[model samples]
Target: STNLSLSIDDKFIQSIREELTDLQRRLLTFSIYDKQTSIKDLSKESALFLWFQLFKDIIFQLPKSEESKYEMIEQCRQYYHGNQEELTNIEKFAQTYTEQDSIHWYTKQCFISRLCNKALRTQDIELLYIFRYYIQDLHKRLSLEHQSFRNTELNPPILTLYRGLKLTHDDITHFQSNIDSLVLMNGFFFTTRNYDLELESALKLSKHSVNILPTLLIIQVNVQLDHVIFAKISSQINNSNEDEILFDIDCAFKIHEVYFNNKKNVWIITMSLTNENRLIAGKYIETNKREIEQG
Candidate 1:
């Protein structure tokens, strides 16, 4: 007779981390593989989406506290324990950070960006909750910039943006297949009007591995669309150019085209902003509001 035990790998741990976004998520997501006729499936989907909105709203509404800020810095210290420069930056951040410096710190791409970007990309709710104060500050700054766009006459009716990056062949293939589908980016979308392709964006293929693709995203936005919020962020941060435009989190885009530019030997994917978020979650938000008011 032999005894067998189950083992979880890094990949399985990652999937579990993504699924467990909040304390209440277990009630909604547990037994996704089990067939249960007790509840309507669509309702569960709606509830999960609604929970995300509610979770973010609650985090944003919570009062800023010195304790939360200190905890964030401490977590940064622990997370970057092996990196001396990041630990030094964490110490400085703990001692001298002001509310207004949030946007600058984020764009500086230091420890804050490192944590925030990873949390967003991986849907790491625990890390996101810890950094809620800074996240709210960044969102507020972008919101103000977005609002100011309405009054600026210099703002164009149509804007073109570019982002240079490298992706796996599978990533490019997914884009190619989902040409007309909606793309909901997990975090802030960074693009520039005059993007010079970065050297790092070009992946060097070797005999051992050649699954990389250089991707250049061409995003066009109709400035007339008021549903999604985006703003020019170059002026907000130091040591930056004027070409940076940032789309806020949770904004949805429609993929219009995807093709390989044979001349440049890179993939060119085009997308446009859309109001799909409102289309999907507007009603749930209203119901959520009503339930909150009733409770």
Candidate 2:
């Protein structure tokens, strides 16, 4: 009886060892294939905890690129501190972008464009407009830093609007005004029974020269290309106002740089009239390459 009991205990130990070895083999195989056990097998809270643990482990295993490290540090900081650092390395990262950096920007633009399109479809025009301006701001920062970005095979459709906007500041302003006035200008502003006609008249009056030093003078009569439209115009072409002139000069230099690259100048103008704000942009193809070069 004593011998039989000892034998039974030995067999039980062997069985436990065999079960552990099989389990270890299966776990190793799953890890190799990047498979996780079914979530259905665990409670929701347990699954969430497991996911967080796995995320931490993968983050630790990432290669030691500066960006990767910085991102990891930021994630950990934000996760624990409930906010990001005020002096975040965004500026540093933007400065370091080269032609290779264009891919990442392009990827970012693509993702944002999808979101913007969804907003547009839902008639969330304000949100869509914000997304458009955000992209412009990003591109301007990248361009001003003189970064060369990689060419993307798939161009975003908004690039057409963007290219057109770069023509002259007024051109962008005109485009933005058209969008805004389309939404706001109705007979409600005036007792005129011809509200539709008045809106059409207003749009006609709002048209400005798309040329260099485009005329922006104001007038009284409600007519197309009239002074009444320019009366409320915000930007003036005086080379005297030092601060304003410097801002315009900066824009001029940016156009010069883009022209040299065989690219058209696309300018964006943000303007506010009364309670409404609008964005104007355009694309202007340069014909005087020799003249520009001489200048």
Candidate 3:
């Protein structure tokens, strides 16, 4: 230890203590995010408890105005200043994006999808607030699309969708424990009506890593279901041949069954869109949204 002067003893000690505390916080945060860290998954109730609290702070924090929206886009523009292609896309988005094109921009391989998905999954309040302008528009667009989608006479009464993703043991266990419970999707859920492509993707991902389990989600949606919004958006975007369907952010679904398919060496979970759980969320969230819109 360095020798300290008597006059500086108390102040210097406090400063060093504060520095140590900050350093410790940084280390702990890093460890929490480390891939090797084994963190227990929060139960659905606990996670939703956190979500409602966080949503209260986040959903209302965004300043609604033309300038704030521009500033948000400029922040994204500055973020990708180093990348020429993204820079061009960002500029084009700023000049050309209409509310109807929200899904088109989102489905594109760009920063909007990456940033919004990450912020939504992590529930990063600051980023959520920052991107609120685009997010709101995207959800609005999806709702409009949903109306047209369900009314299409050719569409089936019950639509089945498939998603392929990699999950950890904790992720699988979380679903297992939450059977017959409501799950609020935190991000924009992407799936396709094509089974072969999804299965192939699941197989490829399953082989990529042993630490994560390959999972296939078989989601069934009833066109008559209310209080949830999703749409067949492949028509809205160019060059998308997967017959892609996208569910709006924060849509709620019921998990009916989860099982490991031993033959395929993958976990298959089945879910159905339900309005029963959304009735609870709707009561509170609708209140807040109405207040925000009225203001």
Full-model lDDT for every candidate: 0.65, 0.27, 0.70
Using TM-score as the yardstick, the better of models 2 and 3 is 3
Q: For candidate 3, what is the total of clashing residue pairs?
A: 0
Say which candidate scores most in TM-score: 3
For candidate 3, report its TM-score.
0.76
Candidate 2 deviant stretches above 4 angstroms: 1-105, 108-110, 117-124, 145-295
Compare candidates 2 and 3 on lDDT and give the better one: 3
**Where in model 3 is the C-alpha error above 4 Å?**
1-64, 153-155, 282-295
Stronger candidate by TM-score (1 vs 2): 1
Model 2: which ten-residue window has the lowest total lDDT? 245-254
All predictions: root-mean-square deviation over Cα?
11.9, 30.1, 15.2
Number of clashing pairs per prediction, in order: 0, 19, 0
Per-residue lDDT value at 124 in model 2:
47
CA lDDT for candidate 2 = 0.27
lDDT of 1 by residue, 11-38 (tens): 6775554433211111111101111222
